[model samples]
Target chain A: MFSAMIKKELLLVFRDKHALMALFVLPAVFILIMSVAMRDQFSSKNLEFSLFVKDLDKTSMSQEIIKLITNDKHLVQIKEKGDAQFFIVIPENYEQNSNEILKLNVQKSLKENEIEVFKSLLSEHILKARFHYISQSIELYSGKASKILANLEISSDKLYKVKYKNSKKLPNATQQSVPAWIVFGMFFIIIPMSTIYINERKQNTLMRLNSMNVSVFAMTFTKSIPYFLINQVQVWIMIGVGVFLVPLFDTPALAINGSVLAILEIATGLSLAAIGISTLIAVSASSSEQATTIGGILNLLLGAVGGVMVPKFIMPESMQTIAEYSPMAWGLDGFLDIFLSGANTQDVFIDFIKLFVFGLVCLGISMIILQIRIKKGL
Target chain B: MIKISNVTKTYGAKKALDNLSLEIKEGSIFGLLGVNGAGKTTLLSILNALVEMDSGEVEIFGHSLSKEKTKIKSLSSIIPQHLAFYENLSVGENLDFFAKIQKASQEDYDKAVSVNALKELMKQKASTLSGGQKRRLNIAIGLLNNPKVIYFDEPTVGIDPKSRNEILDSIKNYKNFGITVVYTSHYMNEIEKICDEVAIISEGKLVEQNTLENLFLSKDNKSVNIEVVYSNILKELNLKLLDETNIEVPKEQLCELLATLEEKNIMIKKIDYGSTNLEKYFLKRTGVEDV
Candidate 1:
C-alpha cells in the first residue's frame, strides 16, 4: 500500500511541471546568476581600492612606506581623502619620534569583508616598511635579530588566507551561492507541497481516505518521503549548476571539499523541515491561496533572516547570531561546513540536530492539526 | 447494519444534530431527505466516525463505533458530493491506488472498475472525464474497500437529467451487490424511485422515518386526489377539486364521499387511487415546502 502511495505521489510531483520548475530549476538559476554576477566579490586578489597618504614629515622613510603600500598592487595612492577607501597619516617627525605610529582610517560604509582585505594589505606593507627601515641601520642588524630581519619575506606575504582554521580551499562565490540558494529552494517545497495537500483536502480526497482507514499521519508521512527525495534531486541539480553551469560564465566551479554523506544528512534534515512546515500550513489554512500567501511570506522572511539572501560572514555579529536560529541558516551552515571547510558529518552534527528536531516538531504539530480537523469534519 | 442512540452535536450555540437516532438496515437503500443544515450530513459524518458526537453511542455490525473505529472504517465508505479521487491520475490509476489503500486484492480493483463501467475510460485522466463519468468514478473508488455500507451525498446533483438517471441507476445497482446504500438528496423523485426506506429531518431533528411505502401510505395523506363522476355532491361535501374531474380528498374520506354521491343519484363515470403523492407527504412531514 505504501509503495503504491509513494508511486502515486511521485507521479503527481513529476506531472506538475510548475512544481518541478519551482523546486529544481529556480535554485539552479539562482546559483548560476548569483555566482556569475558576484564573481569578483569573494576574490580579494582582483579587488581595486585606493589609499590616501599624507606624508607629514616628507622624509625618505614615509615615502618608502607609501611606495611599498601601493607597489605592484591596485591600491593606488590618492591625494583626495574623499576618493580613497583607506586614509593613512604619517604624523610629524615620525622618523625621529619612535612613539608616533602610522594612523590609518577606513571609510565608514565599507563591507566587513572589504575592510578585512584592506587591513591585511596594510599590515603587510607596514611590516615590510619596518624591515626596510631596520636594514638601513646597520647597527640594528646584529646577531640573530640582524639575520631574522634580513631573512624576513614581508614583500611577498600571504596576508589574509580565507580558508578556515585547519581546513583547505578558499571558498569562492559559486561555492557559497550554490548551497545558499539550494537551501532557499528546498524550503520552497512548502509552495507545491502545501498546494497538493490543500487540493486533496478541499476535494474531499482526505475524507475518502479517512473513511478507508487511512490515518492522517500515514498520508503526511507518505507525502514527505516523495518530496524529500525531490529535495535531494534538487540539491544535486543546483550542485551541477554550480560545478558545470556557473563555470560556463567564467566563474570558478564549486569544489566539494567533504564527503557526500555530509551533504545527504543536511539535505534530508532540511527537506524534512521544509515538508513539515508545508504539511502544517496545508492542513491549517482554509484555502490554497491562504496557504500560498502564508507559506511564501514565511519562506521569504526565513530566507532573509537565515543569510540565504545575504552571507552570514558579511553580516554584523548580532545579525549572524539571529541567523543561527533560522532553519534555513542551519541548512546553509551545514552545507558550508562541507563545501567550504571540508568538514564531515560529525562537524555538522549541531546543524543536523537542530533541523531534525525542528522538522519533527512541525510534523508532529501538523499531524495533530490534521487529526483534529478530520475529527471535527472540517 | 448501523444503530445510533441519542446522537447530538452542537456548533457554538446552534444545535447541528439534536438527539438524532436512526437505524439503517443491511442490504437496504435508505434515503435521507432534508433541507439544508438539516443534520443529514452530521449524521453521515458520525456514522463514518469522521466526527465525534457530543453525546451518543453508535454501533455498526455489532462493533462499538468509538471503540472499533478501524473496524467501522473498513466496513463503510462514503461517496462524497465532491469529486474525491486525484484528478491528475487516470481512472485506472485511481482505482488501483484506492484499492491499495484498502489493501484489497487485484480482484477488488477489477470489480470496482467493472461495476462502475469504467473499463473504457481507464486510460483517461479523471479531470478530463465528463460530469457523469466523474460521479461514476467517485462510486468506483468508494467500492474499492468492498464496504458493506456506502453513503452517497447528492451524487447526481448539478448534472443533466440523462446523467442524473445514469447515476441514480448506478446507485440503485449497488443493491445487487448487497451493499447498504444511504442516499441523501433534495429531489423527491429520486428518493421515491430508489429508496426502500426514507427519513425526513428538519432543523437537526428526525421528523419522520419509515419505509418509502409506509411514509407515502395513502391512508396518511390528505392530498390523494380522487377521480370520480361529475357530481354536485362533491360541492355539498366541500371536497377540494383538482380540476373538474378530480376531487382532492383524504384517502379515508374517499369512499364516504363516493357513497354520498351515489345516494344523491349522481352517475359515476370513473375513480382513481393508489399510493404516494410523495412531494406533498414530504412537505407535510417536515413542515417545510422546499425539500
Candidate 2:
C-alpha cells in the first residue's frame, strides 16, 4: 500500500514538466555557471611569486642557492631583476671564506606578511648550506672531524619539521561550488512539494485520502519519498557536471577522492533534510501561491545563511556561528569532507547525524502541524 | 447506516453546525439541501471523520465514529465538490491510487473502472478530460473502495446535461447495490429526482426532514397565478392579490376563478400553475426564498 502511494507520487512529479526542470536542469546549469565563474579563486595552478636575484659572490655555492630558490614551482625568476616583489643579493666572499659569516641582502616592493614567509624560507636554505659546507670542510681537514661531526648529530629533519593531521588542501572552487549549489538546488524542492500538497488540499484529495483511512504521517511520507529520490539524483547530476561538464568550459575538474559510500551517505542525509523541510513548508502554507512564495524565499535564505551562496570561511564570524545551525551547512560540510578533504565514512559521521536529525525534527514538526489542522478541521 | 446527534462545530464566533442531528438508513438515497454556509459540508465532514465534532456522538454502521474512526473511515467515501484527482496522472493511475489506499483488490478496481465506463480513458491524463469525463472519474475514485456508504458533496455542480444525468443515474444505482448515499446539491431537481429522503438545513438548523413523498404530501394547497391587463377585479373572488393586475388562487378554485374573471370581462394575459417541488417546500419550511 505504501509503495503504491509512493508510485503515485513519483508519477505525478515526473509528469510535471516544471518540477522536472526545477529538480534536474536548473541545478545542473547553476552548478556549471558558478563553478566555472569561481574557478580562479581556488585553483592552485595560478599561484606564482616573482623573485629577483643578484648574485655577487661569483661562487658555485651562491649559484647553487639561487638554483634551489628558482626550482620552486611557485616562484618565478624575473629577467628584469629590479622589477620584482622580492630581490635577493649574495655578498662577495660569502661562500669562499669559511670563517666569514654570509651577509644576504634582501629588498621587496611589498612589506606584507607573505614576504616574511619568503624571507624565512631563504634563511632556512642558507643555514642548511652553511652547515653542509662546515661538515665537508671538517671531514677534509682531519680524521677526528668525522667523529666530531657524527657526535654533533646534525640532521635536516631535526632542524626543520612540521606535522599536519588530516591536512588535505582546501576545496577548490569547482569542488565547493558543485556541492553547495547542489544543496541549494535540492532544498528548492520545497516549492514543488509544497505546491503539490497545496494542490491536493485544494482539490480535496487530502480529504478523500483521510476518508480512505490514510494517516497524516503516511500521506506526508509518501509525498516526500519521490522528492527525496529526486534530490539524490540531483546530487549525482551536479557532481557529474562538476567532474565532467565544467572542465569542458576551461574550469578545473572537481576531483572526487572520498569513498563512494561516504558520498552516498552525505547525499542521503542531504536528501532527507531537503525532503523534511519541504514537507514542513507543504503543510504550513495555506495555499499554493503562498507556499511557492514562502518556499522560494526560504530556500534563498537557507542558501545564504548555510554558506551555499558564500563560503563560510569568508563570512563574518557571527554568521559563521549561525551557519553551523543550518542543515545545508552540515550537508555542504559533509560533501566537502568527501570531495575535497578526502574524508571517509567515519570522517563525515557527525555531519550525517546532524543532517538526519534535522530532517527528523522537521518531519516531526510537520506531522504535528498536520495533526492539529486535521483535528481542528482547518 | 449513519447517525449524528447534537453535533456542533464553531469557528471563532461563527457556528458552522449548531446542534445538528440526522439519521441515514442503509440502502437509501438521502439528500442534504442547504444554502451556502448552511453547515451541509461541515455535517458531511464530521460524518466522514474528516473533522471533529464538539459535543456530539456519531455512529456509522453501529461503530462509534470517535472511538472507531478507522473502521468508520474504511466504510465511507467522499466525492467532494472539487476535482480531487491528480491532473498530471492518467485516469488509470488515479483510480489505481485510490484503490490502493482503500486496499481494494485488482478485481474490485476493474469493477469500479468498468462500472464508471472509464476503461476507454484509462490512459488519458485527467487534465485532458472533458468536464463530464472528469466528473465520471471523480465518481469512479469514490467507488474504488466499494464503500458501504458514500457522501457526495455537490458532485454535479458544474457539468453538461449528459454528464449530470449519467452521474445522477450512477448515484441511483448505488441504492440497488445497497450502498447508502448521502447526496448534497444546490440543484433542487437533482434532490427531488435522486433522494428517497430529503433534509433541508437553514442557519445551521434543520428546517425539515422526512421522506420525499411525505414532504410533498405535507403541502396540501397548490396555487395558480392569473395575470390580467385590468386591475382589482379579483376582490369579489377568494384570491390573494399578488400585484395590481395579478392574483393567486388555490388550484381547486382555479376553474371557478378563471370563469369569474372571464365573466367580469377581465382579459387574462397569462396564467401560471405552481408545481409541487422541493424548492417550494424548502422555501415554505425555512421561510427564505433565496435558497
**CA lDDT of each candidate?**
0.85, 0.83
Q: Residue B228 lDDT in model 2? A: 89
lDDT of 2 by residue, B132-190 (tens): 99999998898877889999999997799988998899889888778999999988888
Question: Which residue pairs collide, candidate 1?
Answer: none
Candidate 1 lDDT by residue in tens digits, A1-378: 788888999988899999898888888888888998888987755787887988897776787778887684758878789888889899888877778898988898888998887777777777777676776665454657766775678644443445455453445898889999999999988888888888888899988888888877789889999999989999998888888888789899999988899999999899888988888888899898999999999999899999888888889999989998899999998898899888899988889999999999999999999998888787
RMSD for each model, in Å, please? Answer: 5.4, 4.4
Candidate 1 lDDT by residue in tens digits, B1-291: 779888899988999999988998989999998898998888898888888889988998899998999999899999888889999999888888898879987787788888788999999999999998898899889888888999888888877899888778878888998899999998878887899998888888988888976665646654456666675556666668787767777777777877877788776565544333777777777787666
lDDT for model 1 comes to 0.85
Which prediction has the highest TM-score against the true structure? Answer: 2
Best candidate, DockQ: 1
Interface RMSD of each: 0.8, 1.1
Q: List the pairs of residues colliding in candidate 2.
A: none
**Regions of model 2 farther than 4 Å from truth:** A51-66, A80-111, A117-169, A249-252, A314-319, B105-111, B219-221, B224-247, B254-277
